[model samples]
Target: MNSIPFDIVGFDLDGTLIDTSGDLAAAVNHAIGTIGRDPFPAADIHPFVGKGARVMLQRALDASGGYDDAMLSALLPILLDHYAQNLAIYSTPYPGAVQALDALAARGVRIALCTNKAERFTIPLMQQIGLHDRFASIVSGDTVGVSKPDPAPIRAMIERAGGGRAIFVGDTINDIAGARNAGIANIAVGFGFLDGPVEQLQADAVIAHFDELVPLLERWPG
Candidate 1:
């Protein structure tokens, strides 16, 4: 059994906190089209969600299956620019997300969002969705020297949250790895951008819905 009663909760933005896949897909397909390649649908690019823009572009191009590195390099900035223009146009928080954040806050849990996305995009999206003030701290890819799956960002969040007990919630293998690397337990949710069952990520616990987090976190041992 995993322990809980965490005083702080760190969340992953793109996949766990918000579903920005629609806008991301729009941008990616725009890049593909600009290069005269076939555009892939949103569903086909789910696995590429959590990482930053550069990595996502690489994954999308890799998925296209015919692009060379030179081709990817040439198309990335265009895709990023397009993505920035459409950020949050249709992007919104996952169902029950705000309620879950509120519940955790009521229980005295500090909330932080630690993402590989650069601050330029991360902050704006949070503001657009009215969740900018919800987080005690926001650590973006540009905030630290290293990103997730390396643990530095998570450590930064923990430090910002005042270093009590904490839990990291996300939907990707990178989040799981980062949480473990930071010495915090993690709960992987299945309702987001993961390409497969969250169990495959080897998280301490797996939640199928946002509402379940209330019970899970409330029951954790301090």
Candidate 2:
């Protein structure tokens, strides 16, 4: 029999499940470079993540130099186009992510992913990374006309995942807040692209590695 407490397990895409900083930095750099700005190192781009591309690019542009509305408007599409074509070039699953997913699946837990990443990028990126089929649901930022920190997407993810007791795992305020808004328990990954310390997200639980996930949930009273 399935022993895990939750029937559904939801995840955040970028930092939680995959390390996408390299590709994201590349896209941001491509946009900023058009204005003759220097590129940001991939690791430096981590904190500016968790939101969507527009916000991410805005932070990058703000950090590199500055931007006006007109300049940002012009560069947004550049960043997005570069990103769309190069989604998974440097993206890879976080260490032990695959094993965690496999363990969840083995125990009959339904896996779902919700991301602030829009459908255009999220879907293709997951497909390229060979994870699209593993999820029972994928709720993108634009999926329900709202995104994380709003609870709609998280709720939608659970419903689509064939709902039951659910727990969310992610790396940002958006994820923790979203799950809380949706009335589910949450776990925060210590190694994700956290803008601040992972504890600040205040997830119900915190894990430093995917290897700790199954054990964590196994202890959940649910």
Candidate 3:
């Protein structure tokens, strides 16, 4: 092990901190149904996640059959409406999620939420999961001029949180790319929506569960 080396920890909300697939699926299906198209299975939509809302919508619409710009334009609103309506119904933190955050807080680590999810949905989701209070900084996709993979979001979180040693935990390529772009180390989790081996993501580390974070943080150079 290279040993964890950071004081502040940043987390990607959707796949890393929360299991949002169910809610996302519900919204996707609702959109399809509203457009008079066949609803796609949750499995089919899972791969479309971790990108962004627009990309997910495009992927979902395409996978269902085929959707031209006109169809997609009409379906997008219904999808967002569905997600807004059923936001918290099926969404929840992963196992050990709360405890991990608690433990990190106890250790005096400054925690930040650096998510590509839009602010309209991000804030409420964190509140629902009881994690809003745990974060010293909450940087959403809409917070800055640029989103993940652009490094601005991560950089914003670190700067807003007082800027020190930091680590990022996420489950997607964008996460890895953003971390790299921000010049920070990243940790990838196995339980999230990413489609392949954690190693292929090229993150600094990869762990299987939330509690594993405790030990990693303990040994980090904070």
| Tens digit per residue, CA lDDT, model 1, 1-222 | 223467789999988989999899888889988877788877887677666667778888777776787988888889988987788887988888999998877777789989988888888888888999989889988798889899999999989868888889988888999999999999998988877877799999988889899888767666
**Candidate 3: stretches off by over 4 Å:** 1-5
Badly placed stretches (over 4 Å) of model 2 are: none
| Best by the lDDT measure | 2
**Candidate 3 structure quality by residue, lDDT tens digits, 29-65:** 8888876778767777889876776778898877778
Could you list the CA RMSD of all candidates, in the order they appear?
A: 2.7, 1.0, 2.6
Which prediction has more favorable lDDT, 2 or 3?
A: 2
Candidate 1 has its poorest 10 consecutive residues by lDDT at 1-10
Candidate 1 C-alpha error for residue 175, in Å: 0.8
Clashing pairs in 1: 4-220, 4-221, 5-220
For residues 1-222, write the lDDT of model 2, one tens digit per residue: 888989999999998999998999999989999999998888888778767788898898889888899998999999999999999999999999999999999999999999988899999999999999999999999999998899999999999988899999999899999999999999999998878888898889999999999999999985
* TM-score of each model, in listed order: 0.92, 0.97, 0.93
